[model samples]
Target: MDLPRKLLAELLGTALLLAVVIGSGVMAERLSGGNMAVALLANTLATVGGLYVLIELFGPVSGAHFNPAVSAVMAWRGELPRTALPPYVVAQLTGAVLGAWLAHAMFDLPLLQVATRTRSGMGQWIAEGVATFGLLLVILRAPPARVAAMVAAYIGAAYWFTASTSFANPAAVVGRMVSDSFAGIAPASAPGFIVAELIGAAVALLVHPLLSPPRAAGREAASPPSSPARHV
Candidate 1:
C-alpha cells in the first residue's frame, strides 16, 4: 500500500482505539458506583470489542499496527519498510492524543487535562513487560485469520492480570497521559511503561523464532513464510 494511505489507517485506527478505551473508562467509572472491578470490566469489554473491529477494519490497509513497539518489531523483521517506521510511529502517536481529546469532548470534560494517576513501581513495570511480551507473542504466533480475536481476548485478559492494566502500547501511554480519566496513566509513569513495553517486545521477537521449527535450506526457497496481518 502507499505510505499515505497506510499512515491514515494507522492514525485513524489508533485514534478510535483510544476513544473507546478512555471513553469506556470514563463511562464505566461514572456508572460503577465506586466498584473498581465492575468499572474495569466494563472498560475491558469495550476495549476488546473496539480493538477487534479496528484490527479487522484496518488490517488490509496498514497491517493495523497501532503501537510503536509492534511497528518497530515488524520493521526489524523486514515486514514493514525500515524507512516507514518513523512516520508510522508519528501517526500512531498523533492519533492517540487526538483520540484522548475526542473522548474528553464526548464526555464534556476538560480537553487539556493531564493524568495524575500514578502507575509506577517494580511490580507495575514487570507487569507491563509481561503484558507486552505476551501480546507480541500472540501476534507473532497466531494464525492470520484468528489474529484479531486472539489479540482482543489477550488484551482483555491482560487488563485484569497485569498490574499496570497492560498499557503495552507506547501510543496508548501517551494518549492516556493526557487524560485524567480512570484509564489514564500519569506522565511521570509513562516512561517506565514505555521502556518495559519495548523490552517485552524485543523479548518476544527473540522467543518467536524458537517456537517455530527450522526450515531446511531447500524448502525455505520453495515457500516464503507468512506474516500476521494485524496487531494492536
Candidate 2:
C-alpha cells in the first residue's frame, strides 16, 4: 500500500480507538456513580468491542497498528519497512491526541485538559510491563484469522488483571495524558508507562522467535507476508 494511505489508516484507526476508550470511560464513570468496578467494567466492554471493529476496518490498509510498540516490532521483523516506522508512530500519536479531544467535545468537557490521575509506582510499572508483554506475545503468536478476537479479549482481561488497567500502548499513554477522565493518566506518569511498555515490547521480541518454528530457507520469499498482529 502507498505510504499516504497507510498513514491515514493508522491515524484514523488510532483516533477512533482513543475516542472509544476515553468516551466510554467518561460515560461509565458518570453512570456508575461511585462504583469504580462498574465503571471499569463498562469501559472494558466498550474498548473490546470498538478495538475489534477498528482492527477489522483498517487492517488491510495499515495492519491497523494504532500503537508505536507494534509498529516498532513489525519493522524489526521486516514485516514493515523500517523507513515507515517514524511516520507510523507520528500518525498514531497525532491520532491519539485528536481522539482524546474528540471525546471531550462529544461529552461537553474542556478540550486539551491535562490528566491529573497519577499512575506511577513500582507495582504499576511492573503491571504495565506484564500487560504489554502479554499483548505482544498474543499478537505474535495468534493465527491471522483469530488475531483480532484474541487481541481484544486479552486487552479486556488485562484491564482487570493489571494494576494500572493495562495502558500497554505507548500511543495510548500519550493520548490518555490529554484527558482528565477516569481513563486518563497524568502526563507526569506517562514516561514510566512508556518505558515499561518499551521494555515489555523488547522482551516480547526476544521471546517471539523462540516461540515460532523457523521458516525453511526461501520459504518466506515464496509466501506472501502474513497478516500483522492487530494492535489497538
Candidate 3:
C-alpha cells in the first residue's frame, strides 16, 4: 500500500523473475545438448511458471509490474502515480541486475561478464515490438483475476513465435545483457531492443482504448477497480 513496501515488492518480484529466466536458460542449455529448440522450450516453461507465481505473489502489493514499459504505461494511464514512476523503474532495474548476479553465483559463472550473443537487425527489432505490443495489450484487457495466468501464457507463446524469443521487458534486456549465457543478449544489442519495446508499449497504449472503450459513467460503480495495470 505504501510507496516503500510497493517498491520492495517490485524489487523482489523482478529479481526472482530474472533469476528464473537466467537460471533456467543456463540449465536448459546445459542439458539440451546443443538442441536450441529443446533448450528454448525448457526456458519457456520455467519462465511461464515463475512469472505466474511471482505475479500472484506480489500483485496485491505492487501490481507486480516487473517491466518498466508496463509501469510507464500505467503511469501514463493514471493507474500508477506519476511521481512513483522513477522509483518503480529504478527498483525493477536494480532487481534485474541483482537477479543476474544471483544466477551467476548459483551456476558458478563469472559475475561481471558481458553478453556477446549478437541479437540485432530489423527482424529482431520488429519482433521485439510485436512481442511487447501483445504483452501490453493483454495486460490492459485481461480480467484482474486472470491477469497472472494470461500474461504468463502469452509470454510463453511469444517465446516461440517471436524472432527475438520475446524479451518483452526492458529490465529483462538489461539483466540479460550482462550474462553471456543462453538467455543473454549482447550489450550492443540492448539499445535496439529497449527502444523497440518502448515504442511497442506506446503503440499498445494507443491501441487499447480502441479495443476496450471506457464504460459509461453509470456503470463505473459496478465495474471493478482498475487501479494498477499489472504486468510482467
Model 1 off-target regions past 4 Å? 216-232
TM-score-best of 1 and 3: 1
In candidate 1, how many clashes are counted?
Answer: 0
Model 1: per-residue lDDT, tens digit, 1-232? Answer: 4999999999999999999999999999999999999999999999999999999999988999999999999888777888999999999999999999999999999999999999999999999999999999999888788999999999999999999999899999999999999999999999999999999999999998777767743463366544425454
RMSD of 1: 1.7
Question: Residue-wise lDDT of candidate 2 within 96-161, one digit each (tens)?
Answer: 999999999999999979999999999999999999999999888877878789999999999999
**Candidate 1: 10-residue stretch with minimal lDDT:** 220-229
- lDDT of candidate 3 over 1-232, digit per residue (tens): 3999999999999999999999999999999999999999999999999999999999988999999999999888777989999999999999999999999999999999899999999999999999999999999888888999999999999999999999999999999998999999999999999999999999999998676446753364466547683544
lDDT of 3: 0.93
**What pairs collide in candidate 1?**
none
TM-score of 2: 0.94
What is the total number of backbone clashes in candidate 3? 0
TM-scores, each model vs. reference = 0.96, 0.94, 0.95
- Give model 1's TM-score versus the native structure: 0.96
How many Å off is the CA of 214 in candidate 1?
A: 1.5
> Where is the poorest 10-residue window by lDDT in model 3?
212-221
